[model samples]
Target chain A: MSSSDLLLGLSQKALQLLQEDADKIEKLIEVQMENLTTRQCPLYEEVLDTQMYGLSREIDFAIRAELIQESAGKQIMVKLERNLAQLYEALSQSKE
Target chain B: MSSSDLLLGLSQKALQLLQEDADKIEKLIEVQMENLTTRQCPLYEEVLDTQMYGLSREIDFAIRAELIQESAGKQIMVKLERNLAQLYEALSQSKE
Candidate 1:
């Protein structure tokens, strides 16, 4: 495969990992949300609503962009996974 | 509230953001996975399964830990959001 193809493949694979973690997290959130007292949700709602807005954008810069973007994407996913694992642990502990 | 309470609140808020992004991404992934050719899943399954293992642990170091952990968690959530935004854009482009 060509370089773009390689980057595309890696990007897709990394995205799949992200999606997987997201799925597990959603279920966790649902359980936590349900158990949270009504009073607590109101306290959190302000912060949560602001952050829950959305996600997406694009760019067309010219210098070695595809590979750079692909590499950065992979690193972000790795960091995301590590942080997520930590967060999951902390949240679980909080629940107990 | 005290500093520890502040840290705990911030950590919980950040976790909520992470959970929100994960939910959106999971839906995106499900759509992509459904559309993916059957042959492709086998190739990607190994990477996906290994990464899917799990998430968590703890540390008991002595210096300014709660604040540090909370700050680190916030930063990770910020980075995670930015990266997720980028990944969402890239994946959407791929689909198109």
Candidate 2:
């Protein structure tokens, strides 16, 4: 289907997931909207880059492990959580 | 500062984390934006309600159990991983 056909009215949560699963062009739009509205365009762009270039490649390498199941993706979650802690610290520090 | 003053640019992850925090009013906007961007808005809205009503109360009860540090929030994370597994199952079910 065309991009226009993919357009759908999604709630905030739905929109965010679409952005995360931006495997198709239409999803790209949803993801961009998420970035634009959140004003985290930079972060979104970086995540996209990481997913496409770095993260996916890393996943491929991880496959060589004994058993890399779906949960393996969660390995990156710690880094993401750490980034959140850093972001909170940064925001708090800037405020103070 | 006023809610208007609290307006800030957040990355997708940052925006998401802010949504999770949603303590301040300005944060309310960031959180809603996150809910809107994601397709599982029903999920987000439910989470907000759970946090405000059921979840927070549960946490208060949980605090009595000793511990209840920052890491305590991760308790809900198990539910998330389960849901991811369930979600994939549901999607696959629907597709098939």
Please, what are the lDDT tens digits per residue for candidate 1 over residues A1-96? 554465455345434443443444445445545555432343443332222211011101101122125455445445544554554465566557
The candidate that achieves the highest TM-score relative to the unseen native structure: 1
lDDT of 1: 0.38
Tens digits of lDDT, candidate 2, A9-96: 1122222332243344234434554444345444654454444333332332223221133354454444444544555455456446
TM-score of predicted model 1?
Answer: 0.23
lDDT value for model 2:
0.37
Candidate with the greatest lDDT versus the true structure: 1
Candidate 1 RMSD to the correct structure: 20.3
The TM-score measured for candidate 2 stands at 0.20
Q: Indicate the worst ten consecutive residues by lDDT in candidate 1 chain B.
A: B54-63
